[model samples]
Target: MLSIVSIGLVGLPVNAQPLYPTPDPDVFYTPPAELAALKPGDVVRARKIDTGMYVGTEGWQVAFRSTNSMSKPVMGVTTVLLPIGVKNPPLVSYQALINSLGTQCNPSRSLFNGELQDAAGAMLPIGRGWAVSLPDYLGPTSAYGAARLSGMMTLDSVRAVQKVAELGLANSPVALAGYSGGGMATSWAAALQPTYAPDLKLTAAVAGGIPADLEEMALSLGFAPHPGFGLAFAAAMGLEREYPEKLPISDQLNENGLWFREFTHDACRRFLLFHGAFRNAEQMAASKSLMDSPVAREVLRQNSLRHFDGIPSVPVFMWQGRFDELTFFPPVAEVADRYCRAGARLEFRPYEIAEHMTTAVAGFADAWNYVEARFRGEPAPTTC
Candidate 1:
């Protein structure tokens, strides 16, 4: 029996909230035993409850809390398993890529900065019928710790979902999928899964236009057009959130990295969209020395997925567009090559005609087809 718990219904008042510093953990909730055992076909709707954050075996488990927009008392659902059985259907986790600065602030929109409502303004298709746990892993850190927190949040959410499932809350296998920054999160989660959630049975991961190497991406975007500047700003926020010591700014950027944090939190996404690829990391930093400094390098290193080595515990399906001017092809190819060489069950699909966004949108069908085939017990494609 699937059960839905309605969490708190707080009005969205325009208040200045700190970004980099972590929020109060009390705001979240853990899945109760009764609520966790929700089955694939069962559906229960509750309102004004909270899915508290639980510390997973790997890292901190972030809570994905949201109020149902339509109903009073804000009904929020938890662990609704979609029946696509294969004994234990592989539990697929969807991580939305980074699209805008304030992306996470809006519950109606996707973490990838896509609209939650469709053109008809209906709730966007959230892989509802699919056996998947799509967590808004960005949490409150969307504008701050974009990549690292995203990775941690993604992995922890998978663990959280698994925990709920293991307690007889849901029944399914596990896999992961994401695009752009989400792709980055999925990559990191895959890398960490072997050590983090070894028994979760993650069979595959699909990521598109993944920003694997943050440093290279930052450098690439730092000098480009207007969009680069927005990326740089976003990177700064990420760096400040993940590694506070790396910030060069005295008080605003410094002081435990929380003071002027709010300024960048909501602003970063809009800045990126408005600027749209004009500037890069080099341009964002006030001085060239800061750009070349070791701290900067360290910040870039921490945000990147390249530092994590070894093939994932599960097979990986990665796609990138040759014309993807945003993330580029070479880096994507390099990561794919490395993973393949490491004997990963890797399917590196490149589209000759598609750009970044178009490639991801167009490739979803193929990606899902691959996922469905795997879920139905189809053999994985040979790496060679």
Candidate 2:
């Protein structure tokens, strides 16, 4: 059974139902009725995708028409749900570093085009007629962590598009894409479609600069110095969301571990931006003795991608830069090898000159091309 602390209702733990629910309708703010008739444009507006728990919150499911094709629709989405204040938008708001952990450290200047730069370094608009963006802040399972929940969130976002279509609001073919953490979500959605939502036709998926193996990342970051501290912070937050049992603290922590946990959660992007300049995880661990507990080790063990049992059911395109310091190449290679051996169709591409940032930027074009071909009813491309 799931439990949710009702918002603004102090000390009352309510039994959360399986289907996502709405907060108190009386207090929840509904979108202005005028927004229903507005077409996609420069301004970002607040709109409710569903009625229940997803209401009141800034979280929204929005539609953007594709410029290239009137009939086709592509969905742009992310898992970060909180309303980003202009003074302090959440780290996930930045499109380029959306997948990276430390976004809050370096906030972007432009809200509309902050992280949406393409390979050529030009601004891409969320115009009427090409792709619809769904800021799926509810995340997978309307919560974070647990890969399967993330997958469900992605699938549901697509379902949201179909729901809008049924109401004569919009229609478009969906090409799911996300970078870094968003990439992980997209990958899970593609893989889970065969069983979870087989009726939804997912043309293709693009997962660039993916951190396929979380455990390896933890192990690597745990042993590294400064950046490792940041990684440890990310791990703690991820574990807390996915596997709270592994958290050592019961009633919220106050120690160095807790301090780092809060700091990392609040400033994940800052840590990533400066991770390479600092020492690896080992140096930091030695100084702080952060990983001294068995619980920390167990968190790494549980959150690692190695714990996953099978390859995704659909064809996947994975790109990794050889020089990526944040997420190394070995674990990604291992995942690709395992999936390929499992007879799962996978296109694994390695960029010799690409690092974490460049890998996603450079590979995104190809990823989109691959998806376009698939959506045109072409056969799956050969795995590289």
Candidate 3:
């Protein structure tokens, strides 16, 4: 039911269809051969970021085709930054703590033009002579809590960015790093890489404040004192977008819940805090509780990191703040232990920080050392 218009711009085969809605889903479906034949790291498009005071750093907004959680073809965008003088440098796929439903907040947009608060901070890697790939990861739809999809996008972004000749990263070593929501993507990507994108050479990964188990996260944070209630809600809302058939969320949500859903469409972290007051899924769902819903239970189980098989083939550095207000330490620790048992070369670091916000900064130096060593071909220490 899409209307066609005559706007001639070149590269047209007389009968070719042009996307009118800017991300008309039809565009993603087209040229199946191109998407299917996409090598793990094929570069689709790259455009330099022209704004902000980015000294000695050249940034690009890249878009590439990657598989979604369901293994369906999807288009993903990332922000790629390179140091002016560095050539063929090591790459770090830094997943930002983007726990927002708004599409504008994704790194491809917000961080691309250096408009968000995290923009300057993300540039730190470029300063280290490491080319950085900051993927929107969540896809064009902004599937905020679709962990596996985000992970796939992360790995694929690394692949696509490496192929960019201008970046000179054709054979560059790769590392993955993120905290909190970003950690969810990092951990999932690491665990999935062995089977999902085994062709890529991943040197190391660092995940801090990881929400390893979503079910536990819901139970522990969907109440008072824990501010993660909003995050949990956002996750559910996001998952619904990705797995609409499996989740069928609208049928389960009450009037108030539906209102919340509409309100969250363009909401970001700052707005989430106030909405977090609901504290419980029962307050949102018509079923009275997420535990009482079979669909919710199944979705939570499937998305958890522990449900997966082999861990990363490369070294992994995981850290958690013992008193993290958002991601409780115990579940994160337990999952790390599970990764260790699965024979992953894991170094689990626990800090005594009182909360989640400062934990990211506290663990920064250690993460840097770990990844830098991996880039230098140094062996990773293991607690296994």
Candidate 4:
């Protein structure tokens, strides 16, 4: 269990803000006893889908018990889309970039209501007769940027799909793919699989334009003209949800900052990016350095995917744009090198004509082809 103790106002006087908003107890967050008793990837409930989530696909939206960042039990929902006329199809968990601060923006919910933003990307695998599982990787609370929690939920979603007798994915080959915020989920799931869910036996994992180092990205986007400043601030709020005691954010934020923080709780990623672009993070928190506190440093380090030493045992394909506006290329390159040095089979590619958005679009073909090849039992090509 992760213990997070608040480091009360140190040489600073400020009003204490509410650390966390109280969520409704009757809804999605209320975990069943079966969920807590089950292991990380155990199914809590399986129900037939009646929603238009995946318009062309017909499958069940399963609710499964998953482990959180604190190793506690939590519930996650996943839409399992099986190929229309195929049997025993290969499984792929398509982690969409749902970078919202609200639960309503989750891909699972969007799929049900037909509001998914990445339907085009999801169509690639669904069109190829591959079974795709779209997991609400951020889980019920919309813990955006909480990579560990995302990864755990993702892995558990796959387990839930496989366990559902109606899905018939028992012996199917599994692959993973995502980009941007979704990439963070894919990367963490891949890295943690070897230890956390070794039985997953993931064939290949593809991540593009990944924000591997959250701390670096947070600091990098702290200044003007960069929409990342808002996104970074959102991440800090997300982290506070996971480690409230450690990030007593309410105490540090000024009155204006407090309002901004609360207002963003239900804001979408698009709204956040342009909401307060170019604002300095220090000004928002009234701190000289966001990482000044020991608690802050530890929380940031713990959440950073790049700092973790786990090397994915499965073949990994990582693609980054030559110039990504949101996540700079240096840290992405550094992570690729780190994985390669850790003796993992990794193919790291940088696209020439790709910006952040274009890289995801340009790399989709390659990413899908890579996963397709893996499902076909072909050996993954490695740059290492």
State the lDDT of candidate 3 residue by residue for 237-329, as single tens digits: 677667665655555556776677677777767677677754555556555344445555566767777666557888999999998766778
lDDT of 2 by residue, 1-384 (tens): 000101112221233122111221421222343533533221122244332232222334343221111111222233222332222221111123332232221112112323323312211212112333434322321223334555554564555544442223233455666666556666666666776676666556667666666555544444334533443444444444444434422123334433443434433334433543443433222133444445445444443344555466666777888777766677777777877888877788888854566777788778766765665667877573
Give the per-residue lDDT digits (tens) of candidate 1, residues 124-242: 22232344455555544443334555655566556555554332324565667877766877887787667644655676788888776666655554334454454455555544443
Give me the runs in candidate 3 sitting further than 4 Å from their true place.
1-41, 112-117, 222-226, 278-283
Per-residue accuracy of model 4 over 161-254 as CA lDDT, tens digit each: 8998888998888888899888989988999998999888788999998877766665555334454666766776677676555566657776
Give the lDDT ranking, best first.
4, 3, 1, 2
Worst window of 10 by summed lDDT in candidate 3: 1-10
Per-candidate clashes, comma-separated: 40, 30, 1, 2
**lDDT score for residue 248 of model 4:** 64
Per-residue lDDT, model 1, residue 75, is: 13
Over the full model, what C-alpha lDDT does candidate 1 score relative to the true structure?
0.50
The candidate with the higher TM-score, 1 or 4, is: 4
Give lDDT: candidate 2, residue 184.
63
Measured over all alpha carbons after superposition, the RMSD of each candidate to the real structure, in angstroms, is 11.7, 11.9, 9.0, 3.6
Residue 30's lDDT within candidate 3 is 33
Tally clashing residue pairs in candidate 2: 30
Q: Rate the local accuracy (lDDT) of all candidates.
A: 0.50, 0.44, 0.72, 0.75
